[model samples]
Target: MKTTGSPAGTGETAGSEANGAGGAPLRLWGGRFAGGPAEALAKLSVSVHFDWRLAPYDLLASKAHARVLYRAELLDDAELAAMLGALDDVGADVAAGRFTATIEDEDVHTALERALVERLGTLGGKLRAGRSRNDQVATDLRLYLRAAVRQVAAVLTELSEALVDVAEEHVATPAPGMTHLQHAQPISFGHQILAHVHAFARDVDRLRDWDRRAAVCALGAGALAGSSLPLDPEGVAAELGFDRAFANSIDAVSDRDFAAEFLFAAAMIGVHLSRLGEEIVLWTSREFGWVELDDAFATGSSIMPQKKNPDVGELARGKSGRLIGALTGLLATLKGLPLAYDRDLQEDKEPVFDAVDTLLVVLPAVTGTVATMKVRTERVAAAAPDGFSLATDVAEYLVRRGVPFRSAHEAVGALVAWCVEHDADLGEVSDAQLAAINPAFTPDVRDVLSVAGALDARSAPGGTAPARVREQIANLRPTLAADHKWAVG
Candidate 1:
């Protein structure tokens, strides 16, 4: 990806316009406009600044769309050969930085089409014979987003694996788990890490679903209806690796619900990452001091020499706002549109583009943070004291000794009050204090209050016990491996 600010260059030229280092001049749409757009409006409206990322997907889609045109008998074998060659040349030029995309075209679609026409003459126009920019754009979006979601999924898997690695290393470490930002229970540190790993696994599933929905081909839906030509949309779909052709031309061009769903999925993933980022920032702070970020992933403040800021994490937490904005912007744009085709749909590309780019970068940085950080096991275990955390354990102990559950809960509640009045930890309460609340509280109740015993007793399929989490990790291996193959292949 290109840096945010760079010198502009002159390259692709259309009509009287000149290409800049940034991208092409507005020469692609020559048949319609007699006068050029105002310079400010041109700069403001040109998407070449961001849409360049779609160049590869656009070229691939063009090739598939062209072959479909050839099969429909609109073009001879020679014409098809020439168009394919020209498109290959275009793809290479774009990849090698030799092709300058002109701004005359509204987007990568027109820019590439115009370039094809320039190279292959009237034959290039034949590529669009049965395809409109409507279906064409939709097809390009699916192709691009499918690949992008896979990339994001791979990054998520890396992050998940990193969390799992951390969990494995800290399997015996203990910490306080909080609710409402106060200590609620003592949980294994490994268990907490696995919790996020599980959340991210579900996130991977959500992206996979989006990719499946976006995999349908929209190539033969010209304008608002089926084309008059005998186009083989399914053949194009197969060539482009789509699972199937779209069932309706009107729906194909009009529907952006796929894109909306993708944004929604990505937005939820971003929210999840943000929650994790917030915790990392909190844990690394001097007050908490439960973890230490490596110097490579941390930054020192300009004025505060002692400050080791979790900038990467804090920035990730902040970036969710951008993803949320993208989701909101796209939904708002689609909410009241009269479809089939509308210029309003043109606004769709930027947000989808931005959201994908943001997550691709953020996920990896988060993964790095997870992989390199040092967990302060001593501090974490030290903070895992028996207090309010044992209240439920005490209640359960009474229940096991034949007291009814509600009565046991009330008895534990009174014992907690006694401990609080005596300024004592639950573990420090005496046998006399135990009987004062309930005779069911025997000496073994003290053993039940230990964090290790509490974790072991909770063992079940999805429980926080070390053995249960190990089993959970074992099950994740084949599932994650299968998904990795699907994404990479």
Candidate 2:
């Protein structure tokens, strides 16, 4: 732990000087260079500021690496014991904020190594004997992402449950279902809400799929090629909760596909969330007035006294772009690289890290927003009856009266045009007028065109009927509950 530098100061003056040996300087990667990095460059190039999030994963990987070395007989029992104990101490220090992470360490890996070497002397050097930063970082990223994916899935489950709760409350409430932004039919509000819950349910399942694929161990890949030492990668994998070890040593260190795959999953989840956010924004708008945001989730504009903007929803929508960009960035970074570890691969962590952070913030907040939201049932029902949402039912009634489907469609289409010209809803038309438009349109035509009748007629599975929506909600409850339990447990 000797250094050729001068004693460093602690204030403004210290900020410009090179760090000395005992001043909590970065001592991990300075072996080849005789001098320390410029203070400015050290502050700029180091990632310990943000990458400190990797500390737990780094310690976990180190313990597994230590066990591998011990099994390989590179360390005696005492050295193995000391390494394990020191690593545990390092983990504790990191967790308790007793650790000094300096700007010159470049990354969490270097900071951890420097701390370990300082704590345990030359015995710490034995930990890296058969591993390289290439494999080490790969292992750390996988471990970090594995835990992050699970956490995000947990948040997603909470969000899904929130939607399910809304569905449970609004199971009988009817709302206008739109296609091309035009009201197509009357659907239960519960069905509309559960549709998003299902989308997010698939998203949770996808994250689990990506996590499974991303959980392989690359610990002993060792810089690229197979290592000269007889290390058991499988043992490291087992220690780290990985189901398997990578078969190709070169690919193990070089592959960022798992990271990109995780980014892909994150991007898709973001898109689903953005869609949900968009609906919340729209439903709260003056035009729709179908839902009200809780005060805690709404923000007011400084100049506009009446503004209660859904800024969180807007931000969630904006963040989807960042997640999608991260996915694309990682894809481009890996596109033309040759097999086995490239410096370019170092750029991989930031994007996925940002995505995990964004989702963690967005998902839970979204869940809270959904959980406390107030659905405007009367407003929804008022809007539901006015938008020609029951036109399909009128067409169906004509079909039931022995008119051909195409003929019924034309008859209803002409009726809708007449109603539009007369500035009236289909329900405002008299039964005589309906029969005049098409003799197949009997007295039941007017009844069928009512919003409730429109919903009732469509009683098939996956339909918008209250009975069908309740069935769907009932079916979803146990499955989502099972998933939530599995994710948390």
Candidate 3:
């Protein structure tokens, strides 16, 4: 494998300076080997393609390590300055898409190390002292994921705020709430939207909690044991914005619980998004007609001239399976691994990257769907009281009239059964029919049978009443604002 030097450099390639006797690019580890690795084995072992996304993080870790080397008296001030300059060049090249990993570069660390050596000669070589690819990759991954967590959180906050805005617009619009796919009661459309907002609020909390555990640095845990040099792990951790260094050297490089936790949070987000997507799909359908998807967020069919499909919602619903699969597959990868780093651990990044990337694309589309969609207030309100949705209100009415709740429930159940047999609506059920079931009935029972009455009756702290929903929205604004500040900051 040959090192490809960038045109900006002095044309002195890493291979020209550090190639093995056989002319293969110098491997960071291969002194003990009799010959270069087989072509198939090298190809199979390389991760530079996917892991190259970690280049910026790898550069940060390298800079930190360089400082540690300088502090330990391993590198002089000039060498440290030169190495830092070369690392900056490499980062710039990477950021500008000029630097890329080759097949010879086994992973991100190797690629960046090769680039640094190409730029600054031996000064670049000194950057790897007292550091192993094991801990280096671990540190890089942690840094990458920490930033990713914040990015995802920020987007999630956006989605939550989108939901809040929509909820505010529809605070008094009636919609049917469901249980087992049956109309359970009437609730404000605002309240239904807030249910999703509340779920995302919990997701934001989970991300914050996960960040605390993820902030432990892995840079000093060199190859599953503490580094021999006088390296300041605490300083490196602090420099990289970590809370602390890992307690155990072996645990530091091996710990992937943070990754799993992120995936879990992501998966839970997928689940919540899928629920919203499912509802969007349902609501946009002609059968339900509760909402209309915006043209920008929806698509038209190829053959059907009149088709307007909620493809964004459909994809969100479909992609949740992919998120769950990524989580399960990652868990499987981590299940039987022994202590410390292994090549198998290389499998971790792509799955999580895929999950996070999937969410990155899915979230904004779903947010736009929610933000731009037109809620059909008349249709939702019309459907709000259908399918015996007022039966619970009827039962509650009897309960308020001094009847036992169980008896009230039984009376309402029988009345509902009667209505079902006669194909009659709850509002159409006469006072005679109500009194036949229970003496608790009066003409006043009809007051509770209306959808608006049903919505206002339940005014407890988390109920679907308009006033309570408004209070919930007001209370959630501060929390969302605080979390958004933290996420963006």
Candidate 4:
């Protein structure tokens, strides 16, 4: 279950063309202006460094848009053939590290268009007629996220299965359930881990729903209006595998609702992972000692020789903040901006890119940490009934024996208080002490005191009872398998 990754911009590798500073400042739209952009503006506006990752997506949209242009008679048969040839060559060069963004290239769209112009002379410039970078970038981003969602989903499924693996093995195992960090009751260990699995399952469902709602193509929404040219937006949309072409051109180019939605989903996944990480941190602690992390997943302090740190869990907990920042930061960038398209939109990509990148790396580590951790069953079982956790069971027992509910509650509270005052274990209380606390406390009250009895007593569906927990684990398996297939397909 080993995993690896680099940061957002530092991928598997960067091409040589990716490293060079612009030989001279280049502006994509300089016809209206007398001169190139100022160095300061260029410095501020430059995005090719990070946006180069979108080259393939930009090229994909370009090819689709070219077909739209050709069908509209904007390009003759020979010219269309030549243009597509040039595009394919440029795509190959980009893939093989032969072509890439230099500082002079304003962005992916500009860089790739420059390559076309270099390859086919005037024939290359023909493809840019009906589209604006506004629409082009919007389309490219959708394409990127459309594919990236699957990757996120794939890893999400992996993490989910890891949790299920742990839960399946621990169905009948006892553990303390808490409210406000105080032991509240007894629960099956499997039930607790399955709770996390359910949260992640919702995240998977979210990504799928978001993908469907966001499958809109933006290519025909040139700038913020429909183009006068006889373009087939629907045809292009089909070619790009979008559900449909966007209905409103203005909303199409200006809308980053999809990006915002994606960030929200990614952030939610991070929050759930962080929760699991936090529990792992607590479980592995000296006080808890209920779980032990694998040596590969755990770390040690440099100076403190005896320190065995749950670094995976701690980092997983910490990265949730970063994922949240990406969401909130994107939301802030999106707020109050007048629409059709603005430079602020450029701010959308990096954060969303980073959120996905962070999750891709973090999820695998957390999954490995969880899947390999050694559970101390004796410790967990012993701790399950501590803190008079079975007090609720005692109350329930009294209720079943025809005692009034209020009277039962009072009797159990007194029994717990008596145990605390005497520094005596709750299980060690006698029938005489039970009768003294409240006549409802019969010898049979102790029947429900054992951890197994407490756990099995919760026999309702979705309860922590062993049989019910096993049912949940069984049902989750097929969903996990389907989610993996959907993610990969």
Best by lDDT: 3
Q: Candidate 1: which stretches are off by over 4 Å? A: 1-45
lDDT tens readout by residue for model 4, 1-489: 111111122122222222223433334576577667778988898898898899999888888888888888898987788777778888888888887777877787877876766566556667889999999999999999989999989998999899999998899999999999899999999999999999999999999999998899999899998899999888999999999998999999999999999999999998998898899999999999999888999989989999999998889889999989999999999899997789889999999889878999998898899889999999998899888899898888988999888998988888999999999877798889878988877787777879998888899989999999999989999999998899999
List model 2 lDDT by residue over 67-143, tens digit each.
88888899998788878887888888788778856666788888787767666655666787888888888998898
Local accuracy by lDDT, each model: 0.80, 0.82, 0.87, 0.86
Per-model TM against the reference: 0.91, 0.91, 0.96, 0.94
Candidate 4's error at 119, in angstroms? 0.7
Candidate 3 — number of clashing residue pairs? 0
Clash pairs (backbone) in predicted model 3: none
On TM-score, the leading prediction is 3
Q: How far is 249's C-alpha from truth in model 2 (Å)?
A: 0.6
Of the two candidates 1 and 3, the one with more favorable TM-score, higher being better, is 3
Superposed Cα RMSD, model 2:
5.0
- Rate residue 178 of model 1 by lDDT: 79
lDDT of 3 by residue, 73-102 (tens): 999877788778788878888888787878
